[model samples]
Target: MSPKQRILELREQIRYHNYRYYVLDDPEISDAEFDRLMQELKALEAEHPELITPDSPTQTVGSSILEPPFTPVPHPTRMYSLGNAFSQQDIAEFEASIARFLGREGPFAYVLEYKIDGLSVNLVYEEGVLVRGLTRGDGVVGEDVTPNLLAIPDFPRRLPEAWDLEVRGEVYLPLQTFLELNARLEEEGEVPFKNPRNAAAGSLRQKDPKISARRGLRGLFYGVGRPETLGVRTQQALLERLAELGFAVEPHHRLVSGVEGVEAGYRAMLEQRRALPFEADGITVKLNELSLWDELGYTAKTPRFAIAYKFPAEERPTRVRQVVFQVGRTGRVTPVAELEPILLEGSTVSRVTLHNESYVQELGLRVGDTVLVHKAGGVIPEVLRVLTEAPRGQTPVVWPSRCPECASELVLSGKIHLCPNPLCPAKAFEAIRHYASRRAMDIQGLGEKLIEQLLASGKVRDAADLYQLKKEDLVPLERMGEKSAQNLLNQIEASKNRGLERLLFALGIPQVGESTARALARRFGHLDRILEASVEELDAVPDIAEATASAIHQALSRPEMRRFIERLRAAGMRFEAREKQKSQALEGLTFVLTGELSLPREEVARWLEAHGARVASSVSRKTHYVVAGAGAGSKLAKAQELGIPVLDEQGLRALLREKVGQEP
Candidate 1:
């Protein structure tokens, strides 16, 4: 076979094996055989580079743009959180509410999916290639974590066909993996994660893709973001379609009838919940019909068509042997109770966080007190209430007046204690660590120990001084061999080109995260420009509020801070924006997509974007045109009300022809 044909065959074979191994838990080939196929594909691609595609298996690894602050992406359609149901009566009330809304009641079909106690992530695909992975941040905007998602071994990186799709699922860590991870953390002298769900979230949110890749994270994708576009009329069919597309759906998802069936399904799942591989705190009951979902509409925060029926928590009585305070990286002093170890849900619960001073005072928690402990949502250990009201010991639960590490006096920042000392050893270490983090400077071979050592030896007082280090200086440090020191130097030297966006974020500006830094860099183009701009100018950037802008202006305008910037610049670091290449032909125009069109909305959007037009999700006065399909809904009405022009598929085509002299 020709190289291209052979490459395609190899990719198909590898995808099938991947699906079998990861999704079906059944492998059709040995590890060696699979590796051989991959090796052969790589060899062919190396010889014939022109034949490579974005969705090729070789392209899946670290394919995401390594921007430090994950950009906040708005969902094409709103991701509504399900309303909760706790009891049989609540389920009955839910059914009744649906009946009341419909004005007539019968047996409406329901789909029950295991509400995996994990982080919800949205995966977006364009032309069969996975483009974005996002966290469900407030249901409307999600933080982009595409790199982390691409690291998942089983990710449906390339669909079987060139299709536009968005699917959502819970990213989870198995109970066994969670335990192993926690044990590894403890061995490494790091704080253990409270539970699997937290572990999953922490793993997925890491700046380094390697961390997420090693976490053994799994996903159970079920819901299609635009089921109407896919012609999937029911939740059951959607789940099946997701499975067919090589995306794993929760295997036990069921289709049933009535509140009684939901209750029964919940009971069945609850009975087998502990035995299941991952954490399950609840089951989601979705109204199976997609048409009815729109008809029912939504509340401000939750969907009217679906409700999560939570399983009752398993609580146990445990005594607080001692209460102690621990300082976080941000200098928040959290009170932790050292409990007399008790077994709850197969794990020993020895410590639980009091959350804040208010919670400690509310619980009236003391050194020696009986309290109810339960895994919150079958995940983090939480205190329910104190069984003993009165103080049982002389050592009372009180907020510390002084910082534990630096001995600086603590002050209240809202309800939490804050250490005002910028020079606090704990905070200093964390700051340096954050600067050298994988998503920031990405100084490889500069581990936490090396950072601590550099700080102790007074060789590098701040993160900027890192660029001033010589290979000879690192050679003297413990565990730093000649080769290792050279590699470290090379890595540090390479970090100079990380760009102004990462530098802004690395400076640890308050409220200036990845997205905020990106906006600032994209807006100002250079650090000097940002420093010259007023707070009003800073606030003009997207997502940067007035207060945040003031903070940024204050930080950048400081004489000491300007000197720091100069030092970084002297070290040959870049301070300029690297804007992405795009067509700016119709840059000022925005179009809102609604209803179904002749072709996929993504296809039209891509074409428009290539020619410099923007595709927006919502209808507003700013919208240039509303693309209405046969079933155009409220967006079209809103656009009309706002005096925005409406365009059907044919009208859109005519406009494209007139504007760009080409067919959409």
Candidate 2:
């Protein structure tokens, strides 16, 4: 076939595969196979540049001209954010207001849907084909994301037979996909996305339709754009019709007859929310009748017809009794505040993270300060604020100059203080603890308390030391039995085979997170190469900021640090041994990944990092590449405007394998 024909065929095949994998959740070809086809197409296009077309899969990443700021288009019906009711009393008040408005309400029912934590989108369909999609910019007007929206599988490129219609829904990424995508980004030395919501928002705003398509973004239709077209007089009917049209509708939507029922539905949704696939911060309670929605109308920024019953803020107040400093696996000193007993979101709060010295200084917190402590999303406990009036005599907490566990003097590297002594007992304890973490070594029987006991008893001083412990050594320690000791040993033995990335992460270098570790592994491909890297060489790696580079350099230069690394090397720690491969396809290319992917992002990142490419976390003019996955959000759009090259996983792999004669 001619090069032109081959390029077109390759594009068609990729688009079809995208539809199958993203929209249908079924893929006929293996990833490697799909990559091979893409490689062939890219090669053909490169040889005959004249064959490149606007719609070609290879063109998605390099477009730099951004369409001007999105002009606001008026919504047929003004979209409104909901008013939140934080408590049952608040809900009761709302119910009373509704009853008064309706005049002697005999029965009123409510429908409950999970309040998806994502960007809101308005899709316009003319004659059953999607024409344009817009962001819920300001409820009444939004930015056009027509191209990006078209890429979404569930978005319905062609709608059901209808004259004209508009549908409202959320654009989001699934948790599983999010985790995998972030892992890959990390592997490429790119910063992982913060959350699923952010990822979704970024994906929908990409300028290139093809880029958006590559990221597996999906939309769930919830409300109608023009109620008149649906011949629907009630919200319940509108939702049912949407579902009937094959849109992914919220499964828990229900219609209850009155206020009591509404309350019950709200509670029920809250209870079952955890089981849902997507993240939901609250439940949305909307008026069931469309006519009533008009009657209730809207306020300036919110609709009166609907009220969002927000889950209580997961916050609680506790007294700060004292501050404690702890050394992390990387030897960074972290300050933790001990809190007085307080109940918070069903759990007793005793302590919270103060992060680093910078955080503590920002809060101007002191010992004996009464502080509001709460877990952000019922997960990580953090100090929200300090109540100054609670105690005037409280002293300012002093940061320790020496490590608490081992009296090593703390060294300051920019904002963070570090326990630079390689043999510091606390640092060793942290390293060992991290090695046994679920994501690391998967050591099942080793809990923090147990680890503390073992450390206190001097049975294990380093991560490798755990491998040397005898059954009797552990069995005698606190609650450890023969079975538990054996289990722990088995886990340690299993960990010996963990790949280079995990080992790099377990080493706990300053500012070297899981993602950074993966990048280092892929770039250096061996522990010895990394350990021997000078500060300047380390700094040259992508995303290795100045501070982090210096810290790693200083740490490795120490005799103790060298000894530790040598010990690990002697103990048979595995490292990447292959010569660096080269791929001209992605050479001089940089990528910034946003959102989630089906495969672990780390795998993709490793491939790229090893193939003479750069991957970044945030968007910038210097960025040469963007490998957007599902729910890519704003970064995708930003990349397009900046004229950065964007690639899907398949395209990226193909690019890496190009120019077989050279090393990646």
Candidate 3:
């Protein structure tokens, strides 16, 4: 077949696969086979640039080596975040607030929805055809990601007949899909994504439609962007219409006629969050009457009509089976606790991070000791306390004095011990593994198991060695088919072209997370520049501590490290400075999120941060705004007592609007 025809066929096949896998949750072909088809399509498109359509699967990684920073567009309606309620009293106060707002209301009805912990996106459907897709940029304006939106399976390319309207919903990666995607990225010698939310957001924002398409993005329509066009008189009616139109409406959404029912609904959803496939940070409650919604109107940034009830974090108990120490890329040792399997939240818990030796000692944790496990923000699992009555004879696991991989004598730094050996095998392997992870190079088909296999087989010695891999070297490995091997090789090749920030983060520098990496990339702009910085120079950057500076300085000082960086640069790695984007309105402001919001808290935090605000985990005197949603508890009262400005959804919207110079 001609290359043009082949490309078309390949595109069709991959699109079909995306629908089957992402939308239908079924697949006919093996993952390896699927990867091969995508690789073929990408190659064909590369050879014939004119054939590279917006819908092609190869466009997801982004197009153009470097594009201008994303421009934000104003949303048609101000996207309001939710206020949170934590305790029963908080719920009662929310009800009272509703009654006061409506006037002469003993009870008010509310609609409850699981606050999905994913990126918030707005979908504009013009006459039943999906026309525009945008991120909830600054609530008012968002980044245009229309092509990427089309790739999401659940985001209907064409709305159902008789349903031509704009709507808002979350674009999230399901837990299973997220895990699989990360797994694939790991197998190809790439960094694994940090979390599902980050993965989903990063995937959706890809400049390349093809890359977005390949990641299997999905959307769930939750709110009417333009309710008047829908001919719906109430929020309930709008949801019903959304359900009729085959959108993935929240199945548990129920309209409670009074405040009592609203509170109950919020409680029910909070309890069910752990059971849901998608992560829900809180529950959303909207006033039922669509007219009331209009009357309540919106502040510059959010609607006054709805509030989100956040679930209080619950702590559960588990036993520590053993303590395992992991050497990170920069050689800092993190102590991890292997817990006796106990069901917590939604999944079975088997492990928790002790953070460091100091943390372990602070908790008085030892192997065979029962400890309380609680998720902070329903995401990170942490050990709360060790039960003293459990027993005392067990020997405490010794903090490793030497590198587990190369037996290099460990060094003491502030708050952490480190493996000073630049050539520690374990450190090298982990560094290489992290460098190749999804958030880094996003090499498909790479995973921990495969990394281990590669290491054991002596096929890959370091991160730089990944780019040098050949299909022949992989095909001979156990369980690796010819197609799988080639797919991995292709992914590795593609990773060589990833941006500087990703490469920096992938390098697994001590205390350098994705955010830090981005910051560094923005500051230094290149690997060579960062390598040349001294400890003091590194510490001069905001948020970079002395220990982090020392670690970075040490890492850069290594001959092998310098060689690896040079090799990567020689192989076409690119680096560029990121622009420092900041918002002054939220400067010095601390927001205490109580319940749920229309958008995820992270998205809201990002919005606030961009505008110069900080999101604190708990209520404190320093907090400036306490956002109280449906089921807010102690925080709300605390805020009131502290004389901090308390904002319901509408109030918060007003604040944002005022800041942005928009009328509330």
Candidate 4:
């Protein structure tokens, strides 16, 4: 055979074996044999890039280079999230609702499949060739994660036959894999994912596909966007067809005749859930017949034909060893429960936040008390209740009179405790980290370890001190080589020009989020103006609540804050705002944007908001315009059905330019 023919042959063989091992749970060839075939294919492709195919198994390793914020891809059909049913009564009510909607006295046949606790994704195929993979970003448009999707061994690169189709699935990390990944993260001193679902999501969103390949993510095909395209009539038939086409369909699905069958299936799955390799929080029950799906229709957020029967939250008994105080960047003191190390939902549970003083009092919790801890949805370990009272030698939980990190007297404000000292070490550390966050200065190389080093050495006392650091100063820190130190210094210098809004946010003013900062920047046009503005003047700005205004007023009036502002101004930071929009062209209009756009949705929203347009997340009669792009889903359909004005990207841009009489 010619080299091209041999490569094609090898690809087919490898794809078949991948299907056998990953989808069918059977292996026709050893790993060594598969590696040999893959190596030959890779060498051949490297020699002749022109012969390379998108679906080549070699591409599954992903690109060596990383690219952030993957481009958005629209789904052919809306990936509606399922409404949850926590109790048996909720399930019965759901059945009754379906019957009511169908106007039928008899119970409807349904299919029950385990709802994998993972990331929802859609894979599109053209002529039996895998073309694109997308995340379920907003039910309409999603980030194009084709490369990452290909990294999963179970994610098919080609179908059995040449056919156009779209299959929806849950991409997940198995429980064992999740535990190992978290262990590795813990070893690296990096924060581990709270659950398998979060781990799967984080893995799939990695900028480098190679990272995803190592994550051991598996996909289970469950639903079809258009089953008729593949000659499938029922949900069960759809799953079977998908399996035949070399997709991993969850094997535990049951086809039940009526509500009773659904109840039985639910019970069986709940009992057997622990035996499954992956985490499944619930069982999804969908109407069996595809013909009735449309008739049953959908609500705004979920499909009416289906509902998820969630299992009860997993609870375990553990002792609260201590209640410690954590001071946030804004000086708010929160009580945190330090629990005895115990495994919960595949992760080690060591700590849970108490939120505030009121929360601590409400639980009547004390040190050495055995408490019932549970992880709801397999995330956020929380203290459910006190299972056993404090032991005889245990003491009542004491509220600290002063900040632990700094000797500042604690003050009660409403239900929460405040450290009040702006210069508190804990607050300074948190403030510096927040200032360097992506949403603020976006200092790429400045992370927790480096910031901690700077704090300890007294090289940086506040956010402004960051701009003054030199390469020589950073090089001495652990893990900071000369090159890395220089890069960090470069990033810090670049951040000085991030403009007035970002500077306002980076200042760490209490109650001033990005939106409020943007509003203040636009209204005053200069940092000096904002600093000089009275509380009444600040309250007059749009979107600035009275409380927020008061907080900003108090924060800026402090002597320490005034000195900090002066230091920032001395560092050559950009303090003047950008030009304000001259016209309120879309003053009375509200727009809902859906699907892929030339620019990001947030950027579009910001521009529209600058011109006095209200951006609504959903479509309604009140929405004056719907900006629809490629692959626009239910929102687009709803807009057209509701007689709401719809505009494509080009049309929307044109309208904006025409209204403002200038480029946006």
Q: For every model shown, what is its TM-score relative to the native structure?
A: 0.49, 0.60, 0.47, 0.53
Q: Single out the weakest 10-residue window by summed lDDT for candidate 2.
A: 60-69
- The sequence of per-residue lDDT tens digits that candidate 4 reaches over residues 285-353 is 898999889788886557888988877666788888888888865567778889899998678999998
- Note the clash tally of each candidate: 1, 25, 54, 1
Give candidate 4 misplaced runs (Cα > 4 Å): 1-322, 328-332, 338-351, 361-370, 374-381, 388-402, 407-423, 427-430, 447-449, 478-487, 510-513, 534-540, 579-608, 616-618, 621-664
In TM-score terms, candidate 2 sits at 0.60
Over 1-664, each residue of candidate 3 has an lDDT whose tens digit, in order, gives: 9999899888778877755443233344433345568767867877889877655655432111123234456677656555455556766776676567767665666777777867778887776887677777545566777767877777667765655566889988888788788655532223445457767877887755667888977777788777888788888888888878777787877778666787677767777666677767777878778887766765433456776666655667667778888876556677888887877667788878776676677777768888867764366576766768766428686898877767766755556676755457756666666677678879888887888888889887777778778888898887899999998888888886677778877775545666667656655766778888888878865456787778678766766567777777776666554333243565567788778777777777666655556666556577788988888875687688779889987888888898854322
Candidate 4 whole-model C-alpha lDDT, 0 to 1 = 0.77
The 0-to-1 C-alpha lDDT of every candidate, in the order given, reads 0.76, 0.69, 0.70, 0.77
> In candidate 2, what are the lDDT values of residues 338-371, reduced to their tens digit?
8787887666778776766767887889887777
For candidate 1, list the clashing residue pairs, or say none: 69-514
Worst 10 residues of 1 by lDDT: 60-69
Root mean square deviation (Cα) for candidate 4: 19.5
RMSD of each: 20.3, 16.9, 22.7, 19.5
TM-score of 1: 0.49
